[model samples]
Each structure stands twice: as C-alpha cells, then as structure tokens.
Target: MSGRIAHLADVRGGYALEADAVVVGSGAGGAMAAANLARAGMDVVVVEAGPQVRPDDMTRDGPAFLSKYYWEGGLRMLLGSGAYPTMSGRCLGGSTVVNSAIFFRLPDWVRQAWIDEAGLSGLAGPELDAAYDRIFTRLKVAPTPMHVMGRKNLVTRDVLDRVGVPNKPLPRAVDGCIGSGDCLTGCRQGAKQSVDRSVLPEAVDHGARVMTCSQVERILFEDGRAVGVEGDVVDLDGWQKVGRFSVRAPRVFLAAGALHTPVLMQRSGVRLGGRVGGTFAAHISGLALGILPDDVRPWEGATQGWGGFSPEVQGLKFEALWGPTALIAAEWGGLGRDLSQMLQDVRRAAMVVMVYRAKTKGSVRATRSGMPDARLWIPPEEIHVVARQVHKLTAAFLDMGAEYVFTGVKGLPDRIRTIDEASGLLSNRLRGRHMTMTANHVFCSCPMDARADHGVVDPEGRVHGVPGLWISDASVFPSPSAVNPQATVMALSDLISRRAADLSLLDA
Candidate 1:
C-alpha cells in the first residue's frame, strides 16, 4: 500500500543474507562507517528505514515535505508533564538531510569532559583534531558569507553587539550557497551538503550497497556471535509489508541515531550491558523571532544561521535563524488586518536563536506504530528564566531596530516592543503549543566508555555485551554536544569503522 513493495506473509523470515558487514542507518555515522569499511574491501550493506530521498529530487517547498523530511510526516511529538512536539527527518539520509547544516566538531571542553568523566578513549587534542579536520573538509564547513546574511542575522548581530553578546558567523555544510535561504525547505540551490549528497554517495562509490525502505526488526545470532539480521522491508512509513528479507553480516553497525537505535535493541530484548537508552538527552533548544519593517527577503541566503554563539551567562547559546515564509506567516497569527499586513511583509522578518543547557529529564518510547516517540519536560521555572533571557535579547533586537519581538507565550515576563497593540503576538507566535517543534540534534542514547557497567558500547563502539555488534552515531555520545552533532557523529563513525575493520581482519 505504501510507495515501496513488501510482503507480510514472509515477514520474520529473513535469514541473514550475506554481507561483510551491515551498517544500519545511512546518515552521517552509518554513511561514514559504511564507506570506510567498503573502502577497506568489506562488503557493507546499509539499511535505512526511510525511503531514499536523492539530492536531485528535493525542493524548497512541496507536498514531499510531510512524507520526506519529517518523521510520520512531521506528526511526532515529545510529551510528558510538560510536552513539546518534536519533528525529525525519516528519509534515507535521516535528520542530516533535513537539518540546519551548522557544522561543529565537538568542542574541546566537551570532548575532554567525555574522556575524563565518560571514560571515552582516543579523542585527545591531536587525535580529535585530525578527525575533525577530515570531517569538516568533507562537509565543506564554512561560515554563512556576508552576502548571504539575511536581515535576521544582520539585525541579531547588530543587536548582540550592542548588548555585548559578541556573536560570530556560524559554520555550515553547504557548497556554492547562493543565499537562497532554502536550506530548511531542502536547499533549492546547491547549498546544503547532507549525507545523501556527501558521505552516502562516497559509500556507494566505495562498493557499499544502500537499501532504502528497509527496517531491521531484530538481529539474527548464530551461537553466541552475531551472524546476520532479519526484518521486513516496508515503505518509508512503518506500515505492514507484503514480503520480507534478511541481511547477514559477520558484523553489524547500529547507527540508527539516538532515538531509534536503542528502540531497536529494546524491541529485540537484546540488552547490551543494560545501558541502552538509559541516559538520553540533547542540548535543549528554542527559537526567537523578530519582525522588521524593510523587506529582508526571508527566503534568501542560508535559512538556519549567520550569527553563532555568544558568551553565555545562563547556560544558553544564541544564533541567528529564519523560517519558511509559511512558518513565519503562521506564527504571525493575528485576528484580521494586521495579520494580513505582516504576511505581506514576510520579507521584512528578522530572527534570532536559543540553545539551552540540557539535563537528562528526557526519554524515548517506542510507539505501536513502530516509531520512537520522545518526551521532554520544560518546567514553568525553566520557561520563566528562558523567557526573561529572550525578552532581554528581544529588547536588544528592538534597540537595533526591530518592530516586533517573538518568544513563546508560556512565560511572558513582559511585553517590551513597539505597538502595544501587538502585545499578544509574542505569546501567540512563540508558544510551544504550536505544531512547530523539531529534533534534528540527537545525542547520548547508547554511550561508549571503558567499562560495560557505565556504557553500552566500548571505546571503539563495539557492544560490551555482544561481540561484533557496534554503535556509531549521536547515540554513542557520552554527553551531548553544545553545538551541532554532524561533525562529531562522522568522526566517531570514522574511528569506529576503521577499528572494527582492523578487528575483523585480525579475526580473519
């Protein structure tokens, strides 16, 4: 019934089809691992839950957005005592294809923290520096050019400077960006260099076979060793399939990212050191928007960031960002005429960013639909603090010429902007109640450490409980990265894949 062909009768029937290794997920981690292994002459088969969304086919705006970039067509949410809807990509390249390509290798502070506290080995200065260099060069990490700085970034920079925030241009994974600002809508120009166009292609070039629309339900073991895996191939959605298949490899790399990988292990009851999905978290993030008067062309240049982190006082980092005109217009939900005027002036929108210090009050639960659902608790106290911080930043933006200020409605400390008539807009526009929550940055699900008691996988990402089973993704982060996770994921996978290959050779 879905776009891909599958059979149910033959389900639960796959008997480890032969491959040198099976790499689960084709995002930054799996792609890099698969490519590296294949380059080492190993036959690597990559399994992806979402359908293959080629770089050539993506558009800035289309019906494809629901089915392509978003999980369950953007219907996923993070619910709990304090709930928030979170959207993530489900396509072949996973979230990497759809994320704002703010490239950041793990900062030295965080890397050292993992080594000292988390027991992860081999990521000291020179070691991590080389990996970082390789991954950044591959992704073409660079700052949003001055010409590409939209009004939002410009205004935010000016405002932040006035407030002594001292922001800088952020690095991103785009090539030949024409400042079309379609990075979120799918980079209409040849800007964003997601894994679909970068590492995955490299893997394919290195004799790796990537099978999209393939979901691995369970791993098949022979005796005490990992022999292969069995599962069904369904459409991108986790609908029932007609036929089934099994992929077999002596080694299996679980790189399904932070959310789904542990769910896969838990569903199979393959408890690895009893540490799967136990400690999951991500850097808490939110959005701040500013409305301007002149036409700023919201759809021009990179959509995510031009300005980067400023010195933080409350464990927060602020960047510059813009949304699709549709999202902006929707956020400008006014009663009648003012709404129309704002929508007409979509080009005049300026934006800023918010990042939070994450704590482990988060979790991922598998739903009946075979999808992993997330839940977050943003307390009223947290809201109050964040709101005050945002309000101050908004005042700064207004100081640098902003007509309107936008932060969520939950904790409105005060309305400080032009046109007291627009007092209600902040609460309305910045409400977490809106259907615009997202979760592109994922980390700290299956961690690596010196001991199995502390982490699920070893330093090389090999499962401590099961031999030949490994993890390589944001999931293996002992702690979350304050910045983007792409560079970190790639470098870790590169290290793990190389080591795994060496182990396989020795065993052979």
Candidate 2:
C-alpha cells in the first residue's frame, strides 16, 4: 500500500504527527534514507520545504522555473573575492531535479584518502561498494547514447579527439534522454532519474508518508536529545506560511545540503562550537564559448554529454555546456546590437566549461530573513588557476578552427582568435574581479570526522554531542569530493540510514 502524500491543501489549521523517524529535504540523501527506513518497516515521514513537481509539470521556461523551484529565486551567491552564484534547487528532490544528471563514481583515491586521513574506516569495504551498486542500478546509470548526444556534444568529442585529449561520453542517471537540452530548468520528459521520480516514490510504496510544503525550522530537543521538528506549512503559490506543523520522532535526519544544513543546526541550538557552519567548500566552475564557423545548434544536444580530464591538470576538468539561448547569451556581455547578433549566431556557439576544486574553505550563516548567506574567498592564485583553465579551452577552440573564441574575461579581447593571443591575454592580468564564477556542488559545512573536535558529526554521521540527530547529506563530507557529489551523497546516506534502521530495531 502506498503511503499518503499531504500537501498544503490537505493540511488544515496545522498538523501534528508522530513517526519512528523523520527525514528532512527529500533530495538525494533524504529520499534514499526514507526508502531504506521504510523498507525496514519503520514509520517514516519525509518533510520537504518545496512543492512536489511531477515531470509533466516541468517546463523549459528557465526564469519561471528558477523563481518557483530554486533557492533565493536563483540569486543566491557566494560573497568574498568575487560574487559567484551557487545554484541550488528548493523543490522536492532538491538539486537532483535540476542538475545535469551526470554521475561520476567516488574516485578510488578519494576513498583511500577518506580511510587513511579522515578516519572513515567503514567507507572502505564491501558495504560502500554494495551501496554504489544498488544506487547505480536503481537509477539506470549509463553513458549518454550517440543518437541522443546531438551535434553539439559530438563536435566537442571530435575537437577533444583532434587535440589528442582523452574524452568520453558522460555517465548519467537517465533512462531515455532525448537531448532536449534544458536539464537545468527541469526534465519535463521524465527521462532523468531524479530522486523524486525514483526513490521517493519507492519510499511511498513502502508506506512512508511524504509531507510537502513543510519547512522544518529546528530540531526539537528533550534534555539534549532530539525528539522531533517544528516549522511552518507554507503555501506554494505565494510561499507564505499558512500554518504551523510538527512531527514527533525517535530519530531525525538532516539532508538539507551544505548551505542550509549548517543554518538548520545552528537554529536548533546544536552548534558544535561554531564549527557547524565553517569549513565550507565547493567545486568552482567557469566557461568560455567556442564560436564555430558551422552551425551546431547548441540547443539540440544533451545539456552536458561529454567531458575530459587532462593528465597535466590535477585539480580541474572540462565539460561541454549548453542551455537555453538566453542562458548562453548571458555568458557574453554586450549592448543591444552585440547581444542581438550573439542571439542570431547562437547556432554557431558551443561552450566548454572548466570546473576547479577550490582549496580554501568558506562559511555559511543565516540571514536576517532566515535564509542561508554563504561566503567563499577565491584567492588571487586560484584566479590565475581559473585563468589557466580558460586559456586551455580557448586554445582548444582556436585549434579546432573556430571562427573566434569568446571569453568574457574583463581584461581580454572579446574574440580570441589565436593561441598566442589567448596566452598573452591570460598571462597575469586575470583577477577575481574579471570573471563571474559559479558552483553547484557546495559541501563540508557540517563535516564528519572521527575526532569529536575536528568536525560537527562523527564517522557514523551522528552529531558529535547530540544523540538521535544525524546528517546524511553532502554537509557531512570531510572535504571536497573533487567531482560531482550526488553519487557520494547517496552512498553515504545509504550507509548511515541502514545503520540507523538497525539501531532502531535493536532499541525496539
């Protein structure tokens, strides 16, 4: 029997419910945890702050979708050396719904580092491998097929091949991707296997109840032990609090991502000596456009189907990027005529992006309005690192016989036509102020460590000093993953949640 789904309309004056466990944030981690616990026969309640949006309900309208489903209406940014946008979704299934569906397994070197340096011994054995297998199978993870890769991705593959750079099709959590090229807005075709469409429904089939439009404010405590959560039931249309709600449970799981998870912990009075919101890290990314002489119709391809890593570059990787025409044009800064011409020439545009793993840590705090205010400092050296990345991609395009490469670096020429020009342009003048940087994979705010004082959570994801409270999200990463975090997040959530279920049974 499928459990009930309660929306704002179903919630009256308020709601007071009880469950064996309550999971927050319905994204990758939360949905996975809920499914595991529910299958274990525990009564689970999944509370999400955003509305439940089905695939058919999704649209290609980027602005409208961002306003409704994204945090801070897609305007949330990191503040420090430069203002960099952090795109995180606020809808049910969270970022998995808006992400490009790319799946990269946790690197073996990163795993070894976790065991040796981070003291996460349990993450090494068959249990972690089993978790990866189950998730990969469940999501139907595979490489994007050639037919659906479209001309843009194919051209990128060709360019990398010609440059003697090893590249391949990106593995994605998708079943029947049509390459509509709007994965960021939302997958209207239901092809992308986001958690809401896969694991969350499986959880409901296991008799786990899902409560939408339910924003959890804080963890309820009884003598320093977590007992439940309390917050507002919000109206989705206006985003106004329509009623108050509470859920009493023996266990509470936090999967609210990196930015908001720290704020949530602080609000619940579970601050671990101000470490809850510190040590924030991210994979900072920037892009340069390759204006091809031939028409590639950038909008027709898979959003990001091909990518490569350079043997020379240690901390950065490259990918083919595309989106709505407006999003692509926004990368090129100009006046009316220039903008209009760029729009007209959109078909001749192919974008190459560089994602750099940030070395410096950042911080996240709750704003006066109770939203997450995140800040990260990109040092001048990292600025040069990003500039080097830009130089590489620009050079690749010039070698591919591109009509011109458009790099939006403030100090450089609008069109870089030669390798020498790009080298001289990006030699030393690039500063944080010259580029608009962004990151979607933000993590480590509530990092986990074996030592109690080193991080907010213990190795098992239990809050160091707060029993009955656990975090099963990227917030618990000891450090940056140096790749996309969704796969690692789900694997860790699976390990932690299954343990939680076993503990619940032992107590019973």
Candidate 3:
C-alpha cells in the first residue's frame, strides 16, 4: 500500500509496492478496481501518466486545459468510413476530470440492447441498476439546478420548448456547482466531483497509492500471464522515457482508456483475435452553434446541461453544452478583421445538444509495434441525416431568436463573414473535411461476441486467452449508450471489480 507520487524523474529497482494488484491508468475504471481491491485489504497500486491537476492549477474557464490534458491536443479526428473528430483527456485522473460531469446511468433500453445484441447477460437490467445505484451513492451525483442553468441553458430550453422537444435538467457529480460552465476546461472550484474528488481519493483513503506522470509504455508478460507493466516517467507534458521498470502483480487490470488499452495488450504479446483497436465510434458528433443578440455568457451554467434522443427526431440527439469565451471565439469562422468582430460577440453564443448515430466504421491500427495509427472515416450517407438534424435543430434555435447559426464552424474549411451568408454553408455545405472529435466513452474493440475470430475480450470483459487480465472500461461497451458514459462505465466497472474481488475462481 505504500508508494511514492510518481513523477517524470522517478525510478525503481524492482516492484516498490510489490503487492497484490497493479492497475494501469487511474481513470474511472482503474480507480474503482483499486477502491474495491484495497478495501478488501488487497495491496493495490494505481499508476497514471499525467500530472495531477490541483485546484490552484485549475483554470476556471474555457477548455483551456483541453490542449494540456487531452490527447492529440483535443483535436483527435475519429475518421469514420466518413470523417470527423473525437478527442479525449490524458491527465492523472484522465478524461474523467475534464468531462462535463453529467452522469447518466445506462438507460433500461441500453442494457437490454447489450443483452439482445451482444449477448452480455451479466450486465442486464436489475444487476446493472444495482451497480449504478452503488456508484451513484458513492459519487454523490445530482441534477443541475434550474436556477443555475445560466443563460445558455435557459436559451436552449426555450428553443427546445418552441420546437416541441423536451429539455430536462441533467444530473452531474458535483456538489455546489455555480454554473461556471467551464467543465471541459477542468473544474477549479472543487465543485465538479470528478474521479479525482471522488473514487481516486476514496481509493487513496483505502491505502491505495497513485503514481502520477508515470507513462506505462507496455504490459509485460511472462509465460503467457501478465506479471507487471513498464514505461517511463512523464512530465507535465505527455512525454515518456525508454528504459522501463517492471512490477510483479498476479493481477493486472488495463484501464488505459479505449484508445490505448488495446494497444497495450497487443504490445504485451496478447492477441485475442487481433481486434486490438478496431470497433471504434465517436457518437458521429456534430456541434450546434447559434449567434444570439443577448449576452448569453458562454461560461455560465453546467458545461453540459441535459439532453435525450428520440426516434422521432431522426439521426441526431439532443444535449445542451456551454462553452467559454475563448472557445466561442475559436468557433467563430471568418478571416481578418471581420473574424475579430465575431470574436468580440463571443458572449452572445449558445450551443445545443447535437449528435447523429455515429458509425463504427474505423479502427485504431498499430502504426508500429508500440504506436497506433487511427483508420477512422465516417460514412457519406449518414451526413445527410446528420446535416438534416442539425438543420432542423438550427431552425428551432432560430425560432427562439438565434440570428446566425454555425453548426460545425470549427470544422469548416474556410470562414464565413456574415450571418446572411451562413445559411448557404452549414450542412453537406461542409468542406468535406474530416475533422477530429472526441468522446470520453470507448467500446466495441473488445466486443463480447462479435465472434471469437474478431473479438478481443469476452462479454464479461475478460481476455479470450489471458488468464487474469480483464477490461472494465468503455473498451467493452458493445455499443454506446445514448448519454454521457460515466454512469455506465462506473456501473459496469463496479460490477466487474466486485467479480474480481469475489474470487470464487480467478481464471474465468
């Protein structure tokens, strides 16, 4: 249970903690496992590769920390068979700290869908619900108060009402949220109770040790069993060293997120049908932008308010999102002096919940032995549906008095000067440019029963060949739930951690 705060300059002669388990990636999944295992009196060591962002280190506005914490500078393009972007965070608490803090338990239908489609009976309705309740109680989640909806949520609510779309308040994990609305930037007020404030601290309290800035380069295996991990100490920036150290854990849990977990397994010489980085999705997300007349204060309210989907609504779904002044300014499309003018009006912008059913049309292939090359491209046919929903949603916003609309201005190839000109260039109107997007959720790569020929992990997130290695993150999400995935990930992870702890038999 004793370990040091891992930094870029740290090293070890052998397994320092030398205990029962080693958890790679101190995100939602790993933290949950560590908490359960440590509480059970198992010696647990949690390793992370990013700097620990403290309250003072927290910048209370914009997605300023986005570039700092996110992989690929928050511009990760998940090239579906069509093209788009999907970015994520890479800090100590990982993406959990940088997320919108909205916690939606897997809806009833999602669990049923997994059971019916992917054959994961273990994560069915009642059991999943019980797990959700446990994690929810542990995390102290609550709804975003109406009074704190801020200007953006208020305007979006009116817009949805006018369009006959129901907008509900979202539940978040924070306690005393005052609508600073910079959830993507990293919450500084200690208000957003992300994993750092919740599970990780709990794990630490239960005698778990966290090593920050320690980048795990690869999983080390001996005689086909996971013995430990190796990599280097990373600094504030995301850089790793060469010579690696090893730990000896009979149990190794890979929670390095969706993108890296598969790669890590592959590097460790474990091949479960070789579907390491395949079966990826990004919610095929598109942004909703509106140029309002009033000062909406982009940096107000919860970063993500609330949203739901409707078969009635076509390809896209609804979710309210608020941005900061800098991001709003960045989203403004134009050239030269005119762009400066739009940037000045950053206060008058509010965006809507927007996503079409993203396609599972890409793969994260190993670019080399230790690196991966993303082979993502969205489908062309889906763009019509994506654009249609966006157009309809924009109409609803315009009905609510939005003067100008810029659906994906940040993805636009060129800049538009006037609101009058924006109408001509919103949808298929895009430059056919493949932009990078990011979601905290990861799935399908290790699908339970895509058939053994292609799946990496089984329904229970256990590796097909490895004896004790298991995946409890979004990597095993058969298909994404239609909501922020924290609740689902935590619930699923909680379920798995309990199974790992039960130990009736270890090698499932």
Candidate 4:
C-alpha cells in the first residue's frame, strides 16, 4: 500500500481528489495523525502549503533556507507594545523541518495540571505514555552523542557542571547527527527525524497520499459537517497561485499549526463565539552569548545539544544554542563596523538560552488578506523575569572563563565582564521593549477543554459544535507546555487519531 508525494506541478490547473480523511499541514501533528489513520485502513491525504524540500536540497545558507521554509521568511512577529519575532516552518514538514530536533515528553506536572484543571481525561493514564514510547521508537529519540557535541555545547555543559545545575545531553530525534549546526535550516544529512523523514514516510508506506504546495483555504461543510476542503495550488518558488485543488473526505483534521489553524477556521465561517482564534500563548525565550578564550567553531556542533536546569526557577531552563554566523551575530545589534566585529568574533562565541512558560495569553485574528495577525502583550514583570534568566546565564558563562558575555538586553552594555554588571543591568524594572526574543513554540489558540465555554475543542480534540472536523496540533493545548511541544503534539495526535479510528468516529 505505497503512496506517492504529489508536488505542485502534479496538480496544476485544477485537481480533485477523494480520501477517507484529509489532514491539513504535514508537520508533527498532521503527519502523526495521518500515519495513525492510514495504519487503521483509512485513506489519508495530507495537504501542505509549502514545497517538498528534500534533504539533498538543504544547504548551509541561512537566508536561503529561511526564505524557502520559514513563514514570512522567518520574520513574522507578534504585534503589540513590543514586536516579538517568531518563526515557524512553511515547508512540507512544517516547523519540524527547520527546528532543532530536540524532543521532550510531556512533563508529568503539565499533564496532571491539564487533566485536573481542564478535565482532559483523555490525556490521562498510560495511553499517552504508550504513544510516546511508540513515537520515540519510531523517531529513534536518544541522547545526543558526545562526539557530535562539539566545544560549543561541551563548554555550556562545563559551566552547568561547575554551577551544580542539572544538565544533560539533550535527547534529540536524530539518528546520526554529524554536528553540522544547520538544524535551523534543514538537515542535509537526513539524520533529523522530522515527521517528513519519519512519521510521514510511514504514513506514505501505509498508503497515505501527500500533496505539497496545496494551501487549504476553506473547510467545505455540508449540513454543518466538514465534508472536504478546497484551496489554491501554489507555485513552489514564487508562491503564486497557479491552480486550484480540492479534497473530499468524511473527516478533516486541522493541523495547520497554532498560528494558521484559527485563521483557517474563521475563514471557513465556523463560528464558535470567538473561541477559534482566542487565548493564544507562546514560550518566551532570551539568550546570552559568551566569548570563550579559544575559537569554539560554534557552527560545527549540534545546533542545540545540551540542556541545563536549576531548582530555583521551576519552569526556567537553559539550552546550548549554535547556528549560522550571520544569524547569531544578529543578537549583537549595531551598524557596519560594530556588526563586522561581532561576525568575526562569532567564531569564538556560543549561546546559552533560557526559555520559560509565559503567563500571558494572546489572541490570533485573521486579517482581511487571510493572514494571521497575532499579538501577545508581555507584562513588564515578565520581561524582568526573562532578564533575570539572561543574567543568570551570563553570570554562569562569565564564571566559566568567558572573555565577556553579550547580554542582548537593549539598555545593557553589549559586553558584560562581571556578574555585578549583569545583575545591575537586569534589575527588577527591565521592560519588555528592551529584550530581543523569539518564540517557535506557539500554541493554545484552539485549546481543548471539557466545558464548551472554555475552549474551541473538546477534550478529544473535536471542534466544539463542529462535526467530522478535529484539530490535531499544539493549538489544542489548553495552556503553554513548559517544555518543547513537538513530541507532545505528535503523541497527542497519535492518540486522538487512533482512538477516533477505533471508535469508528469517522463514520459517525
């Protein structure tokens, strides 16, 4: 039961297809859902808005990769008092294609909280653990090997060890990482087990069809039930709409991501009293760069190889980060001469980044042009907390013999050589406007809850008051996950899709 991948050229000038189920967006959630449904003997079609970028086509060119895979060329921002930049992949595999392959299971505390507070009993007990075991086995999730964790990551580990923090080599969804430091781009070595390389391939083997460059604009409804979907077939390079495509199916899974799922629901005229696009949230991140005594060759190691934790800050954690020179240099803001020096110094620099669960909730609304307009207002106190995380990371690096630390807070000096300087710069009143941060882990837009008034979807991910349409993405999270959400997304999708199949819900 082998299936094939259909590119834009394959469906030019109007195409029509039929499937037992259609899953929109072929990232972690969609891919996992498709695989589970297909394995259950349902004919699945996965429609993705982006191109099918192969591993052979991946390159080290940062800008080129960003333009090809990232939404809005990696410059989409959450609009508010302070514009917080965010990145999500727009390619066949979605964000997993462009993100570091770190994988984390749903933390017990987060899961228990969701069950107790949101009444998400479906996520309770051993079912999710079983799903996680399957996904980890399928993706070969394992601790990153020390050999590929070059000096950049090892140095961060050393600092954590000296500080007596809980640190370990990150468990990543990679088979054989060569330490190319190109995870933010794409894995040329084809080692990163992004759904495109793992779950989607299994889905295809189970006869699930994949269509790239097909943007689902609207959910086709019949008698208040999702009957199918239709949208434009976009050109891979220019992104121009060259044709139209439609998929008819009994069930539809909206896994178009947190940012786009709500917009798609609104565009389809699915009314839920503003629940579809409300209550958006994201993980807030801040990074500290340290210049070491010797050239670390930061770009030669695993992009994100290690993680550190401290008991003092419950939801705060640190990760070692490295990437392209130009992208990393963007942290140090300046013109001509200053920027050039930072670029040259990047060879000896590495980053320790902190990501924390945000207490602030935002909203996503669809613009008239059919784009997602997302806004998250971070309170001044949250910014100060993030700055404290940044200060802690900077102090740790400085203590570990870093020549100097780059605290990217706007009001702070570019280079801080002492813990006292870092502390003074990150005082209690630091505002959100002073920090340059980015969030890729965006979710909770279409949260799941037992009560209809609280969320757009039910605890099982079925859209409230919408028949035959379900959501299988991070958008269904009732709250922000304290850890990376890819594994959680995939695991939940697998659970939901399998349960739906087992219960014969597609025909209901």
Per-prediction TM-score, please?
0.87, 0.96, 0.89, 0.96
Candidate with more favorable, higher TM-score: 1 or 4: 4
Given candidate 4, what's the lDDT at residue 194? 88
Could you give the C-alpha RMSD of every candidate to the true structure, in order shown? 5.1, 2.5, 3.8, 2.5
Candidates 2 and 4 compared: the better one by lDDT is 4
Clashing pairs in 2: none
lDDT for model 1, please.
0.68
Tell me the TM-score of model 3.
0.89
| lDDT tens digits, residue span 112-212, model 1 | 88999877757763656766777788888888788777666677777668667767778888888777666665665556888878877777777777776
The number of the candidate with the highest lDDT is 4
Across 1-508, the per-residue lDDT of candidate 3 in tens digits comes to 4434455445432234466888888878887877777777777778886777766656744455666677766666554353444566677777788888778776677677778887677765466677777777777788788877887887777766766676677788887888777677778788887787788777777777777666677776778877778776645433435335555688888887777787787776665555677666556665557778778876777787766565564434677786556655554456687877676566787877565556545566654745545655556555555555665666776666666776653353232234344453345644335332334455555555535565666765677777768787877777767667778877777777777777221221
What is the clash count for each candidate, in the order shown? Answer: 12, 0, 24, 0
* Ranking of all candidate structures by their lDDT, best first: 4, 2, 1, 3
| Colliding residue pairs in candidate 4 | none
Q: Please tell me which model should have the higher TM-score, number 2 or number 3.
A: 2
lDDT on C-alpha atoms for all candidate structures: 0.68, 0.83, 0.67, 0.85
Q: What are the per-residue Cα lDDT tens digits for candidate 4 across 1-508?
A: 9988998778778689999999999999999899889989999999999998877768777788877778888889997747888899998899898889888987788898899888998677777888888888889999999999989998888766765678999999999899988898888889999889888988999999999988889999999999999999888567788898999999999999999999999999975998888789988888888888889988888999998766676666788988776676666745777777776677888888878886876999988878899988788777777787777678778877888898778767788888877775557767667777887789999999999888898877899888999999999998888888999999888878988788332221
